[model samples]
Target: MKHIRNFCIIAHIDHGKSTLADRLLEFTSTVSERDAQAQVLDNMDIERERGITIKSHAIQMDYLLDGEKYVLNLIDTPGHVDFSYEVSRSIAACEGALLIVDSTQGIQAQTISNLYKAIEHDLHIIPVMNKMDLPNAMPDEVEDQILELIGGKREDIIHASGKTGMGIENILRAIVHDVPPPVGDSAKPLQCMIFDSVFNSFRGIIAYFKVVNGEIRKGDLVKFMATGKEYHADEVGVLRLEMEPRKMLGAGDVGYIISGIKTSKEVKVGDTITHVKGGCQNRVEGFEEVKPMVFAGVYPIDSDDYEDLRASMEKLQLNDASLTFEPESSAALGFGFRCGFLGMLHMEIIQERLEREFDMNVITTVPNVPYIVHTKKGEQVEVHNPSGLPEQTIIDWIDEPYIHAQIITKSEYIGQIMNLCLTKRGEMVKQEYLTADRVELSYNMPLAEIVFDFYDKLKSISKGYASFDYQPIGFKPAKLIKLDILLNGESVDALSTLIHFDNAQPLGRRMCEKLKELIPRQQFDIAIQAAIGSKIISRETVKAVRKDVTAKCYGGDISRKRKLLEKQKKGKKRMKQVGNVEVPQKAFMAVLKLD
Candidate 1:
């Protein structure tokens, strides 16, 4: 019998969790010479497009270590903050994890965070110093940090490079020697944690889970602990890592299920499953209810794809539980919907998926941070989308979103970064000098400040030396506004916001220019205006082409050209027809980009 070991690879984004998975597969000979890729576990088109792992994936490989047959079940986890919940869910399914810290970079903010999450989960950790091929690889310093902070055996840190395939065998040996096999009653009632699952038309709900305690087979009936929903299993199989199916999935195994289900929705992941007879009414808790940190409404550019767009969102929700949408009628876009996401990257990812996979053109509003208000009138309310703000309600109290970010960079450029932070009203909470030349700075920064250009700003000021990691820190009260963009004195629902008082003017100027860029040349001179309630501070003019319709008209019909221009004007009319120049998607996009 093969000894089974379940493990997840945890690290910061681009720290190479997927790359580590690829190396594991190669070392174990799970994937052949021709079947290997850089990050094989990143299977989706969007994942490849964004060059990031959006979903958690699992693969099983059989490794022969020191005359022993060890079956390794590897879970590749997402490293970005948006997918942290997904990361936790995947970690819940594993008994051990390989902490892949960059050797040259040492332990970063996210590396520390990921390590803490694993420790909190009570998972045995096997730390590995990866990227030894890089010139800055400091196995000793990282090894010290792991011991000082994580309190693990410092000598256990394995030096390896997943990219160069160096010291990989030692990693395999550590997995077998350091991590223990999962111990649970395989013959008892089935109990598993549903981290994430998807529905396949051919297969019901392909729920991926860990057998926390018990055995579940093809015919087993399982009940969700939360909703009391039950689904009969059609098949249970493990991804063999070789593009083939494995015969069985048991405790300490990472794999997928193919049930006679149709939707990933039914098996809504994070729900615990137990055999009906076991009455294991106990369900796993601590699942964070992630609120969308950023808000944007989306609509089809072409009116005919309305139904298609709805269907696309519906299908997308099955795989992405975080992408949220609700009915939102836009004055300009007609019947569109408001969507919520964790961040700008999340918004872009969803938009890209709709365009690439669903093949639909879309127009998106400016991304805004959500706010929760508690009025003195003893009424509490939440405003997710800026367009959903009520006009008549008397303002009593207001709150805005904020985040706690951990940043690590060289000490030489701290002044530059500090100056940048001051511009955003960032409060420095703490600072620590890790080495002679490096420092770690922690700050309480508004989510809005970091969402758009902070990452790029940090990189530029630090000379590409600074690194960062952050998580949402909940809401804080601040002076904010729903600065509406009015075209020709009409309010465009698409150009609205919840902004800090200080940023209003700069943002206003940026919005005006973006509108000018996105708007096409028209037959009439149009005024592009930016305002905060009737106060127009910045303005631009889109001089319409004097004679866009040439001397030659088809069928002597300037009437046809007039009809075309009328259609264009009608589209602008849907927008808050401010002045004559139409504000295109680019205008709303100004806030999302950095100068």
Candidate 2:
């Protein structure tokens, strides 16, 4: 245990954390040169295609220094703000963290945010400046920023390039010299904290954990503290490039356990595992429960596949504990699950995974944040969907979730960024200079405002230089209204949304217009109307596919043509009253990308 070092990699998005990890693996010979690949930790196809890390990956490496063999357990964490929960989980199980910052970009929003999290955990931090080989790398400027952020000596910073494998040996030496080994007693009762888990068709559920105290062995009877279920360990192994079977895993070692647990609900991330006969008195204090930032309805295209979709989600949740869902029904879409996600990107990834991994075709409703509703009866209720809001008369007020947003960018883009936030009903909290050229702007904004296109717009306005990160700051009272979209005279519950009162009219107009372009024209005219309660806020019409009944009566008397037109108009009016509108899949997604 004294020679075992546990650490995780943390950084902002696109900071070369995974690439640096690849270098470390190669230097240690954990992965052969012939088989090694870029972003090897990002095993998912979507992650490779999009060039982002979505989940935390763990592996163990063996390093020899001064004729002594040391065990180094490394976890590669996601850099996106949407997957910050993964970083937190990774930090919880480690003794140290490698704070990787892009030299060219300096210290960005996530770099600071993740640093604070690691600091809170009392984990030893090793500041490493990555991407030093780039022609535009600003080592001197970024080193100053790192000193200001962490307040360490100038010599403490390590500069390296992940692409060229520069300073790989120095990094390894630092890990052995600076980061402390895991501390625990092998004689104590068995206790391991499960940091992550995944489902396999042949192996059931495989749980990855860091042993905190005592030791676990193969075929041992262990019980999960959270689920209170007992199972015999079918296999126990260390996480290497592959699962290396071990006779036993002592304290301070990271490994996996397969107990043949078939059900997803039986194993949970952050749960504790202990020997059933003489387990630890208290459960290991795992990380906090994940709080979902956005909510939406995910329905199977074919209603008959609802049960299959449910089963797939349960299995997926085993791999991703942050995802939460519950059964919900929609008047327009029928039976579905109301799923909660960490952000818009997280929601998109979940949708894509469901399609690719489970072969389920799903329609997702517009994403929204959970709102607290105070009623006239002195009751508080949480609303996730606009259609779930209480009657307007009974509702006293609504409180929307707010976040403390942190944006770091060059000084020149501050004005444009501020304008965009202000337009989203954000208030300036603080503005400070991180350095001579970089400024950090802090704001208090509604979570719903940034749910859709806020990140996209901020990137475009700053030319992809701004880095944004935010955390929930509780709820605040707001002048909010539920906007309902009606086709002809009937309301489409799936198209309804809860929005701020001031922006309701303009957004309603945009939504109606966007829907007009997406919804196909029918034999009868379709009246697309946006309404709030009894008052209609905006309206657009999809003209009917007219057959020109008067064409048949051409060259006849004017009265004959007029009679033909009148008959056709009456028939269209009757058709409009009875005809139902078919809302296309694109229309549901269009509302999210509305300008």
Candidate 3:
């Protein structure tokens, strides 16, 4: 245990965390040259293609230092704010963290947010300036920022280039010398913290955990504290590039357990694992449960695939515990699950994964944040869907969730960033210059405002120089109203949204216009209206695909043509009464893209 080092790499997105991890693995000979690939830790196809890490990957390496062998467990974590939950879990399982900041970009919002988490966990921090090989890299400036953030000496900061493998050895030495060894006793009763889990078709569920106390071995009878379920440890081993079977894993070791549990719910992430006979009295205090920032309905494209979709989500949830869902039925989309996602990107990635990984085609509704509705009857209602909101007559006030958002950007883009945030009803809390050119802007904004396209807009406006991070700051009272989109006279519950009253009419107008373009023209005219109760705020019409009945009577008298046209009009009116409008899948998605 003295020679064991457990640590994770954390940084802002595109800060060379994966590349640095690759170099570490290569330097330690954890992965061979022939088998090595870029972003080796990002095993998912979506992650590789997007050039982003989604899941926190753990791999153990055996490094030889001065003829003495040491065990190094390195966890590569995602850098995006949406996957902060994954970072928190990874931090919990480690004794130290490698805070990698891109020398070219300096410190950003996510870097600060994740650093606080590590500090809270009392983990040792090894600050490293990555991407030193770039011609434009500003190691000195970034080192100063790092020093101010963590308050360490200048020589303590390591300058490393992941591309050229510079400083790799230095980083390794620092891990062994600086990072503290994991503290636990092997003789104590079995106590392991399950940090993550994945589903395997043939092997059942595999859980990745760190042995906090005592030892676990193969064929041991283990019980998961949260679920109160027991299963045989079919296989117990340390994680390398692949699973390596071991006779036993003792305290301070990170490894996996194959318990042959088929259901995903049987093995919960962040649960405590112990031997059945003598287990710890208390559960391991894992990180806080994830609070989803956005909520959307995910329904199978075909109704018959509902059960398949459920199974797919269960398997997906085993890997991504941040995703929360419950069964719900929509009037327009039929049966589906209301899934809570960390953000819009997380929601989009899950939708894509369901289709690509599980072959389950799905439709995702417009995303929204949960609202607290207070009623005259003195009842407080939590409404996730606009359709769930009570009538205006019965409601007293509504409170929407807010977030404390931090954005780091160049001083040149400060005006544009502030403008964008102000337009979203964001109130500026503080603004300060990290350097003469780099500024950090803090704002208190409604979570719903940034749910859709705030991140994308911020990136575009700042020319990708801005990094943003946010945390929920409870709910505040707001002037909110429920906007309902109607086809003819019938309200489509799926199209309803809870929005700020001041922006309701304009947003409603935009939705009506957007829907008119996506909804197909029917045999009769379709009245597309945006309404608040009986008041129609905006309206658009999709003219019917009319057939010229008077075309055949070209030579007839004008009166005869008029008579034919009149009859056709009457027929159209009759058809409109019975014809049911079909809302295409594209229309539902178009609602999210409304600018």
lDDT of each: 0.76, 0.94, 0.93
| Cα lDDT tens digits for candidate 2, 346-453 | 999999999999999999999999999999999999999998899999999999999999999999999999999999999999999988889999999999999999
lDDT accuracy of residue 519 in candidate 2 = 96
Positional deviation of 368 in candidate 2, in angstroms? 0.6
1 or 3, greater by lDDT: 3
lDDT of 3 by residue, 334-396 (tens): 999999999998998999899898999888888999999999999999999887888899999
- Candidate 2 stretches greater than 4 Å from native: 554-567
TM-score for candidate 3, residues paired by index? 0.99
Looking at candidate 1, the ten consecutive residues that score lowest on lDDT are 573-582
Error of 2 at 545 (Å): 0.4
Q: Give the count of colliding residue pairs in each prediction.
A: 8, 0, 0
With a 3 Å backbone cut-off (N, CA, C), the pairs that clash in candidate 2 are none
- For model 3, give the RMSD to the true fold: 1.0
What is candidate 1's lDDT per residue for 1-595, written digit by digit as tens? 2399888999877777788789889878888989888788888887887789988888888888778788888889888777776777767777789988877776777777887888888888888888889887777877787677677566677888888888888888888887878877677666677777664556555667777666666677777776677766666777775324455556556666665665434656677778777646577564665577777789888777888898788777767777788877787877777888877667888888888878988998877777777776767689877766655356676787778888889899999999998898899999999887789999999987777778789889998778888887878888877676665566777877777888888877877777777778765556767776667878877775654433345576667878876776675555434444356666566556747
Model 3 clash pairs are: none
Model 2 TM-score on a 0 to 1 scale = 0.98
Clashing pairs in 1: 104-136, 204-261, 332-574, 487-577, 487-578, 488-578, 488-579, 526-581
For model 3 the local lDDT of residue 2 reads 98
How high is each candidate's TM-score?
Answer: 0.89, 0.98, 0.99
